[model samples]
Target chain A: MRALPLIPLLLGGWLALPAHAADPADARIATLFNRLAQAEREQDFQGTFVYERNGIFSTHRIWHRVQDGKVIERLLQLDGLPQEVLRVDGKTQCVSGTLVAGVGNTPDSSGRLLDPLKLMSWYDIKTVGETRVAGREVDIVSLKPRDQHRYAFELHLDKDTGLPLKSLLINDKGQLLERFQFTGLNTQAVPTEQELKPSDNCKAVAQVPPQAAEALASWRSDWVPPGFELVKSYVRKDPQTKATVSSLMYDDGLARFSVFLESLDGESVTDTRAQLGPTVAVSRHLTTPKGDMMVTVVGEIPIGTAERIALSMRAQDVQTKQ
Target chain B: MSREALQESLSAVMDNEADELELRRVLSAVDDSETRATWSRYQVARAAMHKELLLPQLDIAAAVSAALADEAAPVKASRGPWRSLGRLAVAASVTVAVLAGVRLYNQDEISGVQLAAQQSAQQGVAVPQVQGPAVLAGYSESSEQATGPMANGVLQGQAGWDNQRLPGYLRQHAQEAALKGTESALPYARAASLENR
Candidate 1:
């Protein structure tokens, strides 16, 4: 009789497995981004868009196309300097001036992809509204951080395709810090062969192993304001000085910060603090038992958090004592 | 401070109803770390009790105090030929924007570069070559200072090294914001604006 009674419970769970109520849409969104990342690596498209921060703005041109599942993208800095980037599957193939030198090959402080699973723990996600961006209707998803440790985000996903049409970064004060939007988008027609090729100015680059670039481990955040996670971390040599710079990045799904630690070349340096709009940077001088070190923390966090993080950084090697 | 008294003070502080004595007590213990922790704890408890997003860790008092101190220190120096200069009254790109605003803005924050580079960034940023330097520089300063009347923020003269590095630190700050997770445009705009200037 007990076995018979438990049969419905097991059946109910078996039936419920496919449609998890907590984040069915979130999984779809993740799948959509993975597809977009793949498409960006392989597809062909070209468009003009304006990039604006604060009040200053500039126009940019990007041509991306894929062949036999292989992707190639060329982004040109239209204004100011004649900078450009030609990449095959998100990894750079060539450059004009500087392309953040060693990007995919180097350990950089830049955070990684948005994992909705981890993010759901920090941010409450919901499909709140709808709008149009880049001439396509988009569903609005707001990722409001569960804690004040990070800022909030509003994303507009293409309704038809599930791709991100627009994204907005906002602080606790409800002020917009940045916006990334596709003013015009098209997946209906693939880009032509000629459009996918880089200009003569696009200098050829040699591919290097990203792992060979740095052999560093993760830099853990000392006191993350809860719900934050270790998103990405890397070490890259300065393109100019050729010195190694260790970098670690953390994210609360919405807000983020980067810590860069570079060895001083016997040069005297002072501490600094700066804020540009919503972002804050805090540098503190620390004298380890080994030698002197400077910790530079840049993020959109409380100034005190930045300071504390800077102070708490311990040299990863056992040879150096905190 | 008594838990009840502290909670009352916190409530007063939240409602902007604290008397001078209560405000002084809070300010005096602001650096204790534990006291500030307590304040935030109280705030979180109250916010949870009321179901609000209360970020007690944000040291608004320190930021406000520092900003006020920075704005006032320049004036307290009183009189000099540079002091009487009215260029600060208007928003001249170089002396008014980068110099005046950078000192205070950077005093609140930091960079990942070498110590010398960090110091240089804090003290000696240059704009002669950027082409659109003045236009973009002015725009960034104005956007950040939109909330109130900008006084010496971009004016009120500081020394040479200080003037130069502030813009660099400011730019570094913007670039750092641009590299994180998601595809937000605000950080892109900030990085673009810094380059524009």
Candidate 2:
């Protein structure tokens, strides 16, 4: 009689397994995500978009053209300050004054497109339904964070072009943190060179080569949230303070954060925390055997995650000699 | 305990109506896999009824616990005094947005970056940034006057390395994110927002 009772329980457990099993719909969603990533670089489009966060809103115009695999893109802020950025062949050619200053003159390599497999590890990507954006039908996809370390994203991609028509960043409370939506879009033909050219007022930018590029071996975090990994590390000389600030960047595929450490040079400075839209900045003083330094964690992450990162910064004394 | 009783206690806890005894019961049972599963289901069902986008698998408890474990102990001694001061500084600097009817007149002197950066952000939402007590004392004069109207007024007269360096740091972070982030024009907008001032 006891064996008979256990039979149904065993059958129930077996039935529950398939709910966690890989479904065909999931594969289809992943394919859609990959297409979205690939479409950005491969497609040539011009569009007007508005980015809104908190209470500030701004409109921008983008002219992205690809010729013989060399991508040329120009972005201009339509509303305020006439800020413009022009990039040729994946490197920044110039930017409007007040946009970027004191940067070194080095060629920037093209950043890789978002990898669907990597993002899958951090977010539960799923197609929620369909919607309309910019007068075109779009498929709504939600990339919910697996943990609290990152925010969730809802992307509405054009069904015909796979270009993102609208994207939203939502906090754990489901409150909209930021919104990027295309007010208008054109997906056909490459933009003319004249349209891609920046205004004469656009100042040339200097790309400084990162100092700690070779051995980011100089600092390490004692603890990072699970699935997060160091993506890049470098040292930059402060133009105003003349301090060499070492920075380490980490990402959990879907979300990214950076830690900047700078020596105080005996100048008194208080720790500070500030949030601008989805970005949070936390500065904390750290005392190491070598000396006193200040660590700032800045990223589009939860305040708690930033705090933990600020606390986990450790000097890599073993590699100090280098 | 019966499943029905446990479920009732879970609901009560979620609704913030649980008594002391029920609270203890829920906390004690929180570690059990089945109880946790049940709790998650309740939360999802409730969220669905409310039409909220609730993630069924967001394990915030685990993330927070992990953060707690990683918190450094060395900063403990100096954190106490500065934390209180930090709150005061935050309060003094916060700009209360009078939502519907308040008109922002003549913000011409404010840079685009400054206006864009803090207008919606300075609502006293937070986590205290812990610095050395001595450092806080140095800026005590300016921080005391950090109240809404006086905030920028104080900063204008202040001649400190922070005033010179912080903008650079903010701009650097934003620009770097723009260059490195492959997402879209959002980073570009952010970098541009930093220049309005």
- Model 1: DockQ vs. true structure: 0.07
DockQ, prediction 2: 0.07
* RMSD versus native structure for model 2: 21.8
Task: Give the per-residue lDDT of model 2 (tens digit) for A3-71.
Answer: 365455445434533542367776777677677766766789998998876556788899988788777
Model 1 misplaced regions, further than 4 Å: A1-44, A99-113, A205-221, A224-244, A251-256, A264-268, A277-279, A299-304, A317-322, B1-197
Local distance difference test scores for all models: 0.55, 0.67
lDDT of 1 at B98: 61
Q: lDDT tens digits, residues B129-162, model 1?
A: 1112222232223343444212112221223322
Interface RMSD of 2: 8.1
Chain A TM-scores for all candidates read 0.75, 0.86
**lDDT by residue (tens digit), candidate 1, A1-322:** 3236545644554454344334567676566556544444444566655654344456666665667776666566678765565555444555554334344332343324566665665566677888888888888888876554566778887777566667776654455655666767667666777766778887765443454224344234445555556555556676655766666666665576777666665646556554444456665666654466656777766555676677777765533333
Q: Deviation in angstroms for A264 in model 2?
A: 1.5
Q: Model 1 residue B146 lDDT?
A: 44
